[model samples]
Target: MARRDFPRRSDPERSPAPREREPGQTSFLGRWLRRLLVWGTALTLLAAMALAVAVFVTERSLPSYERMKSTQTGQTIVVRASDGSEIVTLGPSYGRWVPYERIPQTLKDAILSVEDRRFEDHWGVDPVGIARSVWVRIQYGQWRQGASTITQQLARNIFLNNSRTFDRKIREALLALAIERKFTKDQVLELYLNKVYFGGGAYGVDSAARKFFGHSGEQLSLAEASIIAGLVKAPSHYSPTADPDAAVKRAKTVLGTMVRANKLTPAESAAVDLKGVKFASEQGQNSARYFTDWVLPQLDLVLPDNDQPIEVWTTLEPAAQHAATDAIQANVPKGAQGALVSLDRDGAVLAMIGGTDYVTSNYNRAVNAVRQPGSAWKLFVYLAALEAGYTPDAKVKDEPVTIDGWSPRNSGGTYAGEIDVRSAFAYSKNTVAAQLGNEVGFGAVANMARRFGITTPINTMPAMVLGSSNVRVIDMVRAFAAVSAKGSAITPYGIRKITSTEGEVLYSHRPDPVQQLVPNYVAAGITDLLQSAVSIGTGRAAQIGRPVAGKTGTTSSNKDGWFLGFSSGITTGVWMGRDDARPVPGLQGGTAPARAFAAFMKIATAKRPPERFDTEVKLPQWQLEPDDESMQANPDGYFYADPDGNIIEPGAQGRTPSADSVVPSGEQGVPVPEGAPAAAGDDFLNRATGRQNEPPRPKPKPSQSPKPN
Candidate 1:
């Protein structure tokens, strides 16, 4: 109260003036600013610590650069076709290492022009390229350009997989930086040239030059260099062997890029002869990979182990291999898989196709898969009958007959009452086959298959007369090859010779003493039966304007289809079915399998001289009998003959053998099942699905997302 009197009552509007702050003291506003400074300092320190930790983590996951710098796997296997052309490489294939100075300037410039223009100026990553790529991504909202330098690509190929992820990007950047710090510009370029993968299994610039241009990398011409450079962008899409037009176009783009980069003059670039870049006539063609894969595992058995690279000369004929590949690709059904094996009379494997494409599947189905030969199994059954002195003219009852427990049915419900052995075979009469099996004894038939070099376990079940036992595709090929070889026992072989990289012969195939499995007269009789079948029977679809003796087999419920035969001294066996052994609806051996055989045979036999099959055993008069009413009704309906005389036997073609052969009669509304399991007393080869001793198919690798080219 006294202070209020002494100090004149201050007006509410007039307050005491604020005192000035002391040297060490702060006003309320200053104190707030000091608190903000402390917080900002703490945040800065934390950010610094976080960056340090991130860098430490990234560096720890770096790839072993030292190991990648040198490419030496101790041993590599290079497979060559019969004509001395490379088919495939089993391990990493690197060309003789050439120093940076030895590499062609043209190749160097072309690579730099397309892959990385500032390769010499940048450390490991190009800041300008990264900035440009970022700008393009911003403008287009997609990754249309790549910022990876030559060093980055080298790191990626050597150390990491093609995984598109944020982690991969960071790892690539960090690794690129490390590569720049460790290697000189010339060393980096040399490593990039020596370690990059070219299309068609070529691993280095030198290998690619030799593979595509048939020359050394040091001798690469401008056009060849440009072609090789373009292939690095997208190997498969721009390979000259895969697509010549696309390769030429890509080469031209590389030349244009070179001109812009000042690495090449416009006139020089224009004068570059892209057409003059000649590639090896057959340089690891995609189809030949199957043959190479088959021959790879046999190296250990043929030659002693060594650290040097090996050169395996295989018996594979490139032309025949290509024909088989094209045939399977053209004729195989959408969901079905087909395998083919072709062998010469001497048991030399000429061609083998495991799947439609080697890139799609590498199961080696031709060598590893064991399936019921279907009616094709009749080869052994008939052989047993002939050995038992049954002539082709011998008559067998074709009327429906039931054995003790099972009765096998013909492909068609109706059958001729009385037919000769040849006619029965041609019509694929189930009753006659079962009777022959009983007459000859199932034990004899099993022994016959075993003598033919079939390694699969074969039991003496009466159903085996109709091909019930599982057999490997190569075994089927070998058995048929024996027929082509005049009934001589022989082992199917793909490797002809093996050599060391230093030009030393490691192994050379020497003919083994020929062993007779079946008598020549018996083989001739079997050939006559098979010939009649092809001439006017179920195998008519396999006719290729020349003598072709083969048998068709379709498993019960259409689970498998097969056509195994010999033409022009070449025995080729075809198997079509699902990998899971599931039934293929409407699939018959006379359909797609036979047609594929014909298509492949036409090309395979184009150069080989045609030879007549042994016809010592004459066919019965019934072999040439005219088509009955049922056959006439379904003449063109089964396997379908085109107007041009081409047999277009697809998976949906026939429900019966068709043509003049046994046909389904209207009276028998229920069609007979093929290769059905026969009861104890009666049987043809049941040919039920059996896959014994077959290696499991390899699981397909997951495909990486397509990246910007």
Candidate 2:
């Protein structure tokens, strides 16, 4: 009866019997849940263990807290002027450290607003900041945001090297956390402020403030504080000294950040006048940028590979540098460029103006530009001629001449026939120079130039006598310095001595053994001729109150103009031209370049007493003139004429050649036929024959012929 009335304990059709169970479904779900829970717990434990291991490794590798406290900043290179004044700080330099209590609150607030807004509220590691930075990086597909707090930066700077690595980042975080534990918030802020790099060789906030605002950190205004704060991210790019506009823009951004953070109200932010934020004057700044740039590359040779600071005593005379800069700026035309180099008698560079403005152009024309010396190069030619038994009194014909179909005429197309060597040089007579070069051989001239330290290539052609070859202004100065130094070879130098901060001598310039580059007599003779040049020649503009010896040069087409001169104490060279080599209309070495040289020399020699060039030269036997009257007569008829216009009778010495003796074309020394009609434009005969008086030929234009070069 119970079985019959059981009502079907499980009536599948009426009771909507439990859906047929999928094979192993219940067991599978239970097993899955158990496995998931077990694996999840294991993964969690593994992750926790890994993190613990990482933290342990990072903490173990960290520098000692005491070591962090004693972190030494980068070494500084102190470049000093010749008078022992600090001209510039070459390497990293830190200012006096400022304590936490001395820091202005506005600076702190500005820095926090721009760099790390959560600096005071969060621990060393701000997780929320890190999450936002990561999201930003993902969105930008680059490292656009740095999650590092000021504490992290301080840790990295003081304890770790600058390296971009996951390990380094993890280590930085651990060290930052350790720092937070070891020091208070104020202490951390103080360390960060005092140890950060602020570019322009400044390493601390106080230094940055002093360097940018010429004031201490405690005196920072809101605008100044914001500017300084903005430089912490990219010191060089935002340095006020390098890029003021960018720095101002960055400061405005920081001000906006301050306003947003409620540290500054809209009104205060608007009132922060960046224009009123006075930057430190560039007056005391390193004006010898060209010299400094030249000296920096040589430091490696003088100093050992050590971290110690060094002092480089350079030969730069600030007064001379200023004079040179002023002269070049004042004399150089608007479209033209100029370079000046001044050296002591010993070849030490006293002043160098590489260009009109170092900020705009740094092409060091004085040392690097190799342009035609033009007539200035005649010094070497005359020197070579003197060495070859020629005297300043030797006679040379300044007549129309052609060498290998290359005809070089005088600048004005007028010739002064048969002049003394000194007279020819004074006038920069091209024909006379060519004749002398032919006699002495171009090789000798080139060799003489090399002996005086001209390293540029010199062509062994007749045109080389007129400075057709290229040479540097420094070479010209060095060559002339040898003349001033009594023919001793000179190695142009700038650094006088280099010493470590501890007073140990790293290097001292011991001048190389001086070899005689030119004979004393030859130097004296050349000096006599150049002195004549300044007093009576194209270089008359270069003559200061004191006696000066120099040569003026103008290249073909007036492309380059130069004046190289020297006093007893200093030798200087000035060059002016367009960098493009385009002719400067109406430009000549006797004009602007000579004037600049004179201006600079006047200042350079103001303290020194005037001294005349040594001119006591003994002539060699071959340089002597013959005593015979006929031999002494100028066979080329280049002699002084009498008032009667008749050929003067030969005195015991000589006489001017008669018009009948005038050599005809294609003839060497043949006399013209008697009663030959006077050649057209024979101004010489108009003065010589006293017959057929004619108006003097019109003086040719100044540019009648291209300059010899």
Candidate 3:
């Protein structure tokens, strides 16, 4: 058939089906796809293995488990008043590493019922809880339930950043597993309960129980335990002091949960009543808030370590503090504000009241407010005169005298012509003090005040002779205490002792007073003068039936009034005025302020015997022997005259003591009689330059210069 094929239709001129592809090229796309699939699978498997290793290592090496049973060294400071009552609390460290079994069952049940219900079953993770939390958040459009298991919360609190991130969550999950592996369920629960924050600066369930319920964690009833547990979520919001109603509501919710969880008996549920949550006022519970504040900064600087809590024994007397506060509130005249500070002679703070009400105004008038001290400032003037060897009975001219064009008049606008230093100080005579301040070097007075702990900057002006310089009651009180301490000036101290929780004393505060100012005799002299002032002087209102020394001060226009007094063992300073530096209509140092001082003193010393000055004091004898050249009166005893109609120059020997009185050693050379002028050769300048002559420079003005208000 092939011979004639050309003509046959079926014979097949076969174009030979399109050529088949080569073996390698036939399924190239399929091979490529298979290879890519295999490699992807292998890479994913390797990555998963690495992740597991990393997580396992992290879980095994969590730092918290290493420190799970560790305790922090807390400091407990005890502040005791002079009467031995606790008055201030510093950092107090209290922590006991208790095992889970020993922990109160109520505390455990309360915590479990409120914080995490499935705490025992979860292996550091709860998928159902996470899902439920997520759903709740989604439904509520806010973070409602955290879904954090006990382990998770512990992980976060112990060693995680306060943030919400996937990375943090992953880390938390890994750490939680490690914690569970390292500790028993009870241990983990115990640590969680003891380390959780319970607000009010309380860091654990025990502290929270004490602060909120005034009971120990071990002694908490079911209701109290539940309330404490509820505080873990939002302490501030549920704090009794912040919102007692909210706290009660939260407690009731916790109780309900406990009842549902079978942790509470039916009878317990019926008996549980959370309506009696008592909250202490957060403001000024210490009572010596001002004194405490003043002492803390100094304590921080002197404390051996800052991290540990300290027990500071203070000098505050609660009864005295209360009395001072009551007196301020009861006696402060209308339109007047005031401060009262009481301190031990050794500079220990006893009672400090800053204002009429500590809660309303925390301005700390005792330590912060600086107002003019009217006549109270006169003490430094008197002190300066005493230091210069002048007796308290030294005579000072009370007549008006112009110094540098400044005229000082007596406070009541009348002068006692001539007066002794004792009488001058008793009367609070501004003119006499001004003359004394000018007589002694003005700088001397300022220096003496500085040495006595008057820290406020003082100007060397004559007005400071009267209590014109501004001073704080605290500083003034401390200065006055120096006098009672027999010239020893001690820095004010409020802390007594600081200790560790283990009863190891960290520090003890003993007074560190120094004697750099006036001598004891000089202080005694000044104190005597002040005592006289209290007896019959301007400070009569402050008199107790005991020996006392003090000064009274009234600022210009009666804006500020002050009465500072001291007995043998205590010193107190009081100030009355408006905070705005405005005048208080009729307020004066001898009125309300003085009365308060007296009232407080009466109560403060009710149990103590009166104290006496510990030094011998004698009245000083004064003799003025004017030389012939310096005598003003003539032979007629009333007609001494010179070209200027003033006292003429008298020789040193021209003046003599009265024949009736025996002259002392230094005065024996005096010969001039009153109204007699010195002979030609007996020059007053020569007498001033002779053996009895004065120093090259005139004595500087008084020890303290007065400042204008």
Candidate 4:
């Protein structure tokens, strides 16, 4: 109240005044702290809301519990033999589902011990386990542990696709949480056991148990359960069927895990012996591997653009397949390869052996390998000649011949002089065939081959008459099947019918109306000639105590051997060769190939009765005339008739001269007598007279020839 009453204590030793804070410094700190607190609370709330929204969206996106529970598994594609016997199961095969109550306790314990020991205690996502896994990964510089629990696996398998990405992982986690919320722990376990993939196309635990042990999941032993539990990590690698030792080692690891998890006592774990555990036998599994492999690709053709599982009923006869395989493996020379394909009269593939061992090589020689048919190619040549109005009994000059500088000689390097076309074909006379090719024109021969279903290119060269072009065994079989089917056109097929798992018909092979690919007389004539080949000539080794018709083929340098034959019921082709094209010393088509053919055909046709070929045409009688130059060199000379029914020399009465009375001409290469037929130069005369003496027909339009090997 008194302005001057109090002493001036302010100036008297004022305690050191607190240093004045920088202008607005305290306010700045306060303002910053307040702003930080507000922002933190707002951000925390926003983050919490965002997390809830994400969780809600994820929950909405997940498949419903009922939908997941009712999901149909990916079924197996079953390939069956013609007899309806199981051949092989194609993936992804879901086996019979096992309920939770039906599952073996040992299996569940083993799975829990190894897959997710904390399955019962943890939430859908185990943070502790994840932390441990991350620490372990960081320590090892690689992923050593997976924290995925059974519920998570079930979630991924059921509701999510198999993609290793952050988004997928998040979705998987969310789905796992939802699954746990909706289903009990037992339900999740049951679903996981029923949906997990095992090796050998097995999907569920039941299938795995059966696939490995040939038993039910409920009947699993401790060792069996442990082994099956071990396969969840890498099914193929740890499958007992594929690798028993690795599987045993994995099972032992599983046992140790069980002991550590207190699911099994140490003594009990040690007592589990994998030695007594019998794995499913592989003999049956591999029995049809080769066949299934050949047929697997055909499924797509039968059911194009189909992703659903199906049943393929093939044309394979198990017995026939076994017989063919055995015959090839037994008769084929060591170090050489062989193939056999058998077809029915309607061109259904009965059996096929692509190689000696499919595991060693998967190159399907029967379907893929194109090799020179050698004399087997002569079938087409003879067929062409028959179609050109030449009879099998028509005589062909089997002497040395040259066409465009290509001279073809007989296989034995000896000529039969003048022989019937039947004999020429039976003996595999290259010179006679070349002459026939020249007379009929290689273009006609090529056309004839095309008519018989030979897709390989045919050149106009005379060498093609001796099978200079390569042809597949399947094509050759189809050609022979046409002959066996009495000139019916053939389209070889393997798949007979295809059906979806639900028994819906996808494809069924309805045979086309039979149209003659060749004249009946022509087919009959070829059959007669080929029958002679098997009975008394080059193909005799293929004789199976029944009426059989076939041709033997040996390539140049004996590099390839082949026998294409057919019975009234089945047609088969056999090929033997080295992969490197190296000549097999002393190998002949009439030897190994014929024997193999016989071996398989005998079994293939055992149930069928022997039947003669269709009625053969009666060829008109023809006599060679005196003017025929070929007869001038006839060593058997008593007057021989040429293929044209012309007498080489006339008797005093102009009647046909008797073989006993006609004198042999001592001269060699003598000039033709007056009015004698020119040496294979007159096309009109050759065609009209039905004689194999004309030059090659004018080279037709040049077609694309198959590339030579």
Candidate 5:
């Protein structure tokens, strides 16, 4: 068979014979190379088809070019106080639109260094970055390397939702290509700088600069720019306000990267440190968030429902907000809640503290919580009496009285028999308030309250005269604001102007015609009564030397302590109580509430021009003679005397309020006379606190530092 192998091949039906080894035939390795090339070519065709299918599917899901071009950034609602300071921002907070040329070159370089070093060289989708990110992901995990270019991020932010899926990533890549084709590199960079989000409810590099460094992006220092650049990686993780140590650490990394990228010299980076950067503390920024929250809902009433960016200018005063927060933090007792609301004569809210710490409880006591006002409600009762032709010196019996089977007792369970109207109001005599309500008619008092802006339900019961009816702190503040406005009807408001970022006025608060809630003379009469209350009565602790008028109120069982005062065209109301209405021990209106009012007004009115209450009306002297019958054997006799003709409450003995109205010495806004005795004025506070003859000293903090926002 072997000898006939060639002849066997000639037989067509037989199997082919084994061929002899031919000369110069291919080797085994060559065969293997051929097989590998064929298989590799087939795999390359299949992969190309897969990529084409992926691109097709992703492009179909992508937003239209027109949609992407017309896509507007999120509508930002920037709310600022009247002083042009930001209180809060609703939705996305955008800063001033900056052109590419205006973008800080250092910031741009830092961003490029940290975000994508080949940003200028890439055409939206970077092959090198994608390969590296893929390798990193394979070694580590997905999301470990974003591999997003500047244009890619812009595309994702502007055109895509934040869905971390492979499909969305493909769509983002397609959108980035489209963006790069439609826009220039410089334009893409500009949009990214203006659209990126920094932590703390701020968006854009400009806002981030202003937020962290208190300057515009154009004014960013190299250090500040580096810090902001680092935030783009993880805003919440590296924010200056959120994690200062992390922020500084990340910023140093950015500087190092910049040096390596040839964008910054090592010496230049070494010369810059954030040590004295002075992260501009908006001293009263968070303190006024309550007012911002209040004004936010009202924007719906004024603005159209379109998604256009807008700016809201509110009536909040930065100084007033700081003062209110400082006072409440200083005087409000531990385990108790406190709130304060201050308004200008035009009914514009200057400041509002919803609680001791907004971080703890955002339940706004100023506008939401309804509670008994105690004697503070007497503001309406006495106002009604004045409207009924009662004078400040008019006599009203302080003897026991009953109405509708509800008999209210005086603070100390005893009342001076037939005191003048001023004395009765100053002493907070419940009996006198009862009699005045009876004479004025409870309905009339309720009408007066309504006229002064109290919208809560009120009853005609006699106890209502002693603040038995529940009301909001804002109601009391508005009523007092009416008095400060010389009896003009005051409608409490916070928003002063609403405008577009383009400077178009959308809404402006128009000054309404002054509607008289009470005659000017009646207002003056009530002012006299309130002034006496602050100077000598239960509200003695609320005196701040300048012409001040106020009233103090203490609910039954000491469940609530309140003080409402006005000075220099500003009216402020303070309330302290437990959220559950449980009694706060020894919490009288004269204790902490009045002290907060005094301290707040002292700082709030410091920059305001000195003002005085008009007291030209001819009337009987408010100062009582020594032979006054009410002073003898009275319940408030020895425990309450101001030696200077003012009456102090027994509970508030030794610490008399500033009796004399002293002019500001123009030094630090303190009203202490330059040549006066050291132990004469505020020295009384020193004596009570065991630091007699010394200047007013700041009290020690009562609790641990507040939680971070």
Candidate 6:
């Protein structure tokens, strides 16, 4: 009873009373202790608020408009043809930029409905919209939605690399908030429009408009604008180039979104009027767009934007281009491809054909191709010798001789016994040329080729004297032009001048003529010899009824065929072959490409006067070396000795090689028999029956060796 009275307050089933405890312990707290605990919590909250304010103040401020503007900027490649017509294209991607006033209402409505309904009202980060997006994403069990405003997109594109990381997300949020403070809603929309990609080489609304409807941004129709707007999420999936049907379907979905968001009433949606729009031709407007592709890389080094809007005045001659193109299309044999180029005497490329049809295949045969020049290389060999003071009349034995394990053969099967330089060239005797190249120093021939602008990899082996190494058609044109110009080596050029759109001159190409190569007489000799090539050698098919000088070349097995010749005023080079190196049967430079050359030059040289090389240059006469005389024991119809010590001949084994006599296996170079008659005058240089002199003997393939230090 006493315990109950003493504790009267300590009821087990009700409220307990305070209890005394040891030094640092208490059973229940008094009113003062409770107040202290409450006050401590309030102070802790105040400190946290102060720290947060300090953090907010510490962040460096950045301009919102600058961030937005940076995001929308992109790279664009505007290609213009040599004729100054726009063609082809490429770009750096972001949002498709459009002017605010030019944006279609339909496009604006669709984008707003899908991306940010309150884009105009929010200051970039919309709390309510984010909450709604989170709810939707959670319900869908995946992140299928976002609440990012246009400003957020700008922040991500401009200041961030394309990475999906948490840090980036935080940065995006901060940047978005900053952007809203600087740019107006309309300005932000404009930046967004100009920054996005619509695929198919389109960047920004203006580019997209030009690409899809062949019009500017201001002229875009509602349907065109909607199509572009639909490409925001995935440009490739909705691109007309990649998937037109998918693009249209995506555009329709955008329209549906606009309807659902009440951005467009049902009646308004129905009345908005859209027709399926057809995009511009993916190939572009310039007819010679492939040629433009050839010129762009060079122009990038000399223009504004590194690629666009520069007016490039070029040396392209439409007439020459048409002729070359028509010739290739009409003459390239089945299963065989070909290329051709025409240049003025000054080495300006008037016309270039990359291939038979650039649209079907973009490989540039005119410049990129590097194949054996075969006997055509003889021009350089002979030129070097002539420059070294040897005359075309100089006698060299056409007999087979081995040089450093390489036995160069004549184009025919047999070796001519004795031959003068001119006859050996006309006949394309491999043995004689190889020997001559060796005598003059392989370096001489190589240096001569380099001076002519043959910048490709060179094989300095003695075999290169016989055109054993590879050379490009463009380089060959410059090389041949040296012979046509009588000495000066002119650099080949396509672009003549470049100017900004505002008409300020940026760069101009001056004809860079250099006399680094053959002297005038030596050049004339080479030219005269090459004239024989078209008149009576492997390039007979290229012969025109004018003073034309050029060379013909056929690599072993007909893997390559070429005819590079020119008149006094114009130089043209033609090549025919497969890109994959497949053997071309029943085709040679003399037949197809040579024919094309003839056709093009017929039109090209119609108005030009007949001109001949200056044959009066007092180059020293050449005598037949004894060693060379022994090799000419089997001389073919290709060589003859003159009192002046010069020999002239053609490549055929006899006056006329029987069709059956033509070598069957395409391996060995053509050979000539001994005692073959010398070519009399220029007629002696002309081919007998328009038949290619047999290809020269195959040199021993060089050994693969490690380069020496």
Cα lDDT of model 2 by residue, 372-424, tens digit:
98999999889877776567887888899987677889988999888898999
Please identify which of the two predictions, 2 or 4, would achieve the higher lDDT against the true structure.
2
- Better by TM-score, candidate 5 or 2: 5
Task: Tell me how far candidate 3 lies from the true structure as C-alpha RMSD in angstroms.
Answer: 10.0
Clashes of each: 7, 1, 51, 13, 0, 64
- Please provide, for model 4 over 1-709, each residue's C-alpha lDDT reduced to its tens digit, 9 standing for 90 to 100: 7567766566547678688777756677889999999999999999878866766776676666456644655646877789976667776765556778999999999999999999998768899889999999999999899989888898887767888899999878877776777678998898888788878778778868867887778899999999999999999999898899999999999999999999999999989889899998753533256566777787666677776667888898989988998899899988999999899988788888888887778778888888999899999888877765677787778899767788877766898898898888888888988777776677878888888888877777778888889999989999998888888888888788988655678899999887777657778899989998998899989998889999999998989999999986799999999989899886789999999999999999999999888748654333222122211111232433446433333232333334333322353345544444322324433543577665545434435222211
- Compose the digit string of candidate 5's lDDT tens values, residues 1-709: 3554444345576858789879878889998999999999999999878866766665566556435433566678888878787777777767777778998899999999989899988878899998999899888866487688988899888877888899988878877776676667887888888878888767788778888888788888888888899998899999888778898899889999999999989899898886656676644445677777788888788776957778999888887788889999898888899999998888888889999877667778889999999989989888877765577888768887766677888877887888898999898998888777776577878888887888899988767889988999998898898888888888888888888876889899987888877656678889999999988888888888788999999999999999998999999999999999999999989889999999998898898887889644443322233122111122333323333333344444344344532222443344433323222335443543478567654433544221111
Off by over 4 Å in 2: 1-60, 63-150, 158-170, 178-191, 199-202, 215-278, 282-293, 299-313, 357-360, 394-408, 497-507, 618-709
lDDT of 1 by residue, 1-709 (tens): 3544465777878987788767798789988999999988999999767755655565465444455555454466778889987777666677556678999898899999999999888877799999999999999999999999998898788777679898997778777767776667888898899888888777788878877777788898888888999999999999877898899999999999999999989889888888766677655456677777777777767775665667888999888888898888787777989999999878899999988766777777887888888888888888877765677887778987665576888776887998799999997888888777776677777778888888999877667778888988889888888877877887888888888655678889988898877667677889889889999899999999999999999999888899999999989999998899988887899999999999999999999888998869643221212111011112223333332222333342343433323222342343334432111110111111144445434433444211111
What Cα-based lDDT does every candidate model obtain?
0.77, 0.80, 0.72, 0.79, 0.79, 0.69
Relative to the unseen true structure, what is the C-alpha lDDT of residue 384 in candidate 3, on a scale of 0 to 100? Answer: 72
TM-score, structure 4 vs. true:
0.69
Stretches of candidate 5 off by over 4 Å are 1-75, 131-147, 162-164, 198-200, 252-261, 264-286, 304-306, 402-408, 413-415, 615-709
Stretches > 4 Å off in candidate 1: 1-71, 96-205, 211-214, 222-287, 617-709
Candidate 6, residues 482-568, lDDT tens digits: the string is 777777777777787776534567788876646645555676677667766667766777777777777778888888888888875
Candidate 5 residue pairs in clash (backbone atoms < 3 Å): none
lDDT of 5 at 98: 70
Cα lDDT of candidate 5 equals 0.79
Alpha-carbon TM-score of each model against the true structure: 0.59, 0.64, 0.75, 0.69, 0.73, 0.63
Clashes of 6: 64
Which residue pairs overlap in candidate 1's backbone? 375-553, 406-679, 465-685, 466-684, 466-685, 467-685, 468-687
